[model samples]
Target: MSNVINIWCIVRENRSVFSVTIGTNNNIFDLKVSIKDRRSNYFAKFDADDLTLWRVNIASSVLRNKDTAIEPYLNDKLEEPADTIGDTFHNVEGSNVRVVVEVPVTTASVENLANLFSQMNVSGSSASENASASPFTFFTELVKIAPNHVQKLYQDIIFEKITNPEYFLRNDKIQLGNFAPNGTASVYLRDNPTPTDTEDNVQNLFNDLMLSLPNFGKKLIVKDTHNNPYLDRLKPDLSVFLEEDVRDGTCIPMFVQTLLEVKKKKSESGLADEDKGQLIDYMNVLIQHQQLREHFALFLSDGFRFYVMVYERNNRQYKEFITNFITGLRLFYILLRYDSSYTKMADPRSIRFYKSPGTYTNIYLKEFLGLGTSSRVYKVDYNNTQAALKYTQSGNAHHEAQILRFLNENNVANIPNYITHDGHSIIISPVCKRIRNQFRAHHALQLLRLLSRIHSKRVFHRDVRPSNILLDINNDSVVLVDWGAAIRDPPNEQVLYEGTISFASPDILNNNLESHRPTATDDLHSFVRTMYILHNPSKMPIIPDGNLATKARVIREYWDDSVDVKLAGPLWEEMVNAAKNGDYGILEKCCSIFKS
Candidate 1:
């Protein structure tokens, strides 16, 4: 019990206190990971390994009460990765923050990068002339490496090998086998390559190649990685990492600046599907932890051939395909392409949003229905007519006003016949807050149709919960509200969280962040869960947790006699299957089940 301690840390940036329950025996690197995970969004672009932890000098200054500018006394730095927390810093029980964290600079946003690239504006002729002849089969247009940079790589690396052979041990490239592995041997051979001369030979070759490169030396080192920080069962052949970033608990992907992936010889499995998959998997983990849009990987397709792989992604947050909808995150590699390729609506700079005060000023607000930091909803008597009015700062991209305008234009049902909006909010005919304990089959069907209509317009309500859905008592339907988190066009990859977690889909909650996107199927899952929440208000979240297995079990066993389970239950199963298998056609059928 003495080994474990609760350490409170203060982030020097915003003076936010970060709490962690870790073992005193645990290294400094473990403590950093705990801090990062606790407030991932806050440090989305930061590498925790780069954070500077100082033993809080409570006797000098404090995080909240800035008595001194110089980072309080006792300024004893927790510098060594091998040193244990308890052995280094003395702990006080909530009397003062025991650790001070210094966050490094965050990476630039994708939009800013896009603007910079547009400013550079490479000519079409030069772009075509400079495109490299890539060895990977499916790889597309890659940004041409500058001739000087390419020359640097060749001179500093290739020439290093050519000139200094005696320093580097010689290996026979001819001895490297050219055997192509089919899927049958993939699982066994990849796991246990003890019998293969090729794998070990290639691994050594990869290590030597990275070691010889000018990019890696004393400050940077080459290593073969094993464990993952992001929970993906992936291991790179060799990772080029900053030596300072490596520790007993440090993960390679978190620190790896560039990774090396290799195959013995040119074969079906080499630069083709299998080898590329590993690189892509690693890219997912790296991008999540590194918070960067692009990374590079070194690929050795054969005994003597090496090619550079550039993994690039645009800023868009939803992915779509004509063939099938892959519900989770999917990345497409292309150089120079940005979110400019998507709809103007997805690009926020172009959207026209009314933010100033509206024309109508004569309004007597009676009762307050809801209130938040930037938003409020109230029952008001406006122009001598009773209306439910809501107002807030606009997040205009697929926002409440925008979505409502689109739905209104499309004539989607349950939208109020009379609705008015101006600067920041909307006024609509009063509707009941939500259906209480008596949620019905008819309401279920109406909710299904409402969501179907929204999806039909390519508008997905990222947050679909009971509060966001109001009952149209007179019409026996529902009005879907709160469109601030909605998105339109699909993207190649998305890295932001836009919706509530408990009602989130398996893809969002699955811990493996390889896939994090909003989908029509995500809505279906939320839609079904919303019905359950409506029927049983006491059992709040319905699922109550985001653990994948437990959520599945809870969803599977959930049955309510209050609503028509025969219609809703089968619909849920079909929708869930569609999400997993990319069978979106089944979604229409899933909705039709409510009609049946």
Candidate 2:
């Protein structure tokens, strides 16, 4: 029965929204009263009952940000008097705001119109006289402002605790002495300054200001991040941290007090997502990495203009503050006093390249050694140590890492040595080579033995293709790789198709409906199919015409053809026929298949 749980109500004709809290049983009219109460200044002449309300129903994905006009998107009207607040808005996919009430202009009364027009040029005396009594005149005046000024009026609202509630902003004139009372500051002017000049010049100007403002409150240390990279080569222009928090070069997210990004002009907001989006990237470092702190101040500036925004560690709630350059520095001073006295994170044994839910390879830009439909394998050289790094932009990295760690813990043989993993990359030692037609009968036997050991642990390497079978001839290693598709003792259910179709088990790939559960038998069956095909690719299993009934015929003919030439022992024939004909005896004898 919850209603408007921390949802914002976007009033009409305003650039922003104010948060609304309503009772579960509250109807559409109650929502209107709530909006009018908060915006009483704008709704002075209009009674709460007179205000019209609507229900904004839009997908969360399209909730535009930062003063986006909401008129066109507002199509749903709250005409139902019986519709409770909860029933009005669906919390579908974490909606951002309830853009409900829009302000309606109250037509000025005859006396109020006289008062307003009198001020229009009639006289200052008549304006001062009627202004106090004429609320309609005030509403009329607000209506005359441009849309951008309305944006300014709404941008002033922010979440409590992020800023002082008494803090107010307007397009009021600012005095130069507010920033530099002594004389014209160097930051105000530059020698032939261009768009690029703003970034460095502002950094230098801040450094100069810090030098003269020592102990004005507390000592603050600022580091220029122009050259220092963070979170894998991504860095903000400036970061403030204690000297001790500065490790080898990494900026611990929990310790960074404040961040600033400088842009030359605000119009750069049009050139890509440079303006606000750049601030978000810096915040992402903290929000995605750490869990300790609740909030931090990220300041954005365009030389003379300043902006403030607060995003929690989870980034669910957002608030922005706008001010002139000197006032923005005041906000920076507020950041300096932030209770960064939180506990630090302890060091861990294994390094975390990135956290789970992070499945992109944006951190790496090196050339890859191998590519596949869903993954890329890179040859990385880190501190004289070489390893093959596998990148899959999905949970597959975690899945494969889990299986490799399990098998590695059991001292399983022939699998690549497990190195640490983070992000979408899993590093394994001894880069192995792929085979086209080089697979041997003895190699097939060795792989069967490998799968035997894997199956003994009740783990199924469902994908037994040649590409996943790695060979390091000089090192005498026959390894198995790419365990992402492996299912670990899954229940007997319809097995959806996984792994390369060419090398996958016919039990999985051949069925018209492909309805079968995962089992150790499937791996053994897949291994037999792969071995027959790997020895001679010209003769391979084919689902001719994709007919379910004819699939067994083609498989039988393919396996019989391989067996006719004595490709290997009776194992390939028995294994394929056993799977093709639903023979389960071969599943029990897989350990000794090649041994026979």
Best prediction by TM-score: 2
TM-score, every prediction: 0.33, 0.35
Cα-based lDDT for every prediction: 0.47, 0.53
* Clash number for candidate 1: 3
Top candidate, metric lDDT: 2
lDDT of 1 by residue, 323-411 (tens): 11111001111110111111001101111224454434545344334432244555566667777666554423224556677777888
Model 1 sits at a Cα RMSD from the real structure of: 25.7
10 residues in a row with least lDDT, candidate 2: 132-141
Residue 63 lDDT (model 1)? 47
lDDT of 1 at 236: 65
In the range 1-596, model 2's lDDT, one tens digit per residue, is 45345557665555446676777678777777777787888776566766666566543334445333344344356666667777776562344566556554322222223333222211001112211110001110112222223233333334434354123221122222243454334343333233445566766765555444324244446777856765334567777765655655556544566777766664644222335555544554554333235655577776566777566445456566666666776546543543332112221112235644554233322223444444556555544677777766553576778888999999988887778677466888776665433455556666766777887788887656655676766665577777766767677666454443444454554452244676766776666655544533332333444334354455544434343343234655566666555444463444342323
Clashing pairs in 1: 318-490, 318-491, 319-491
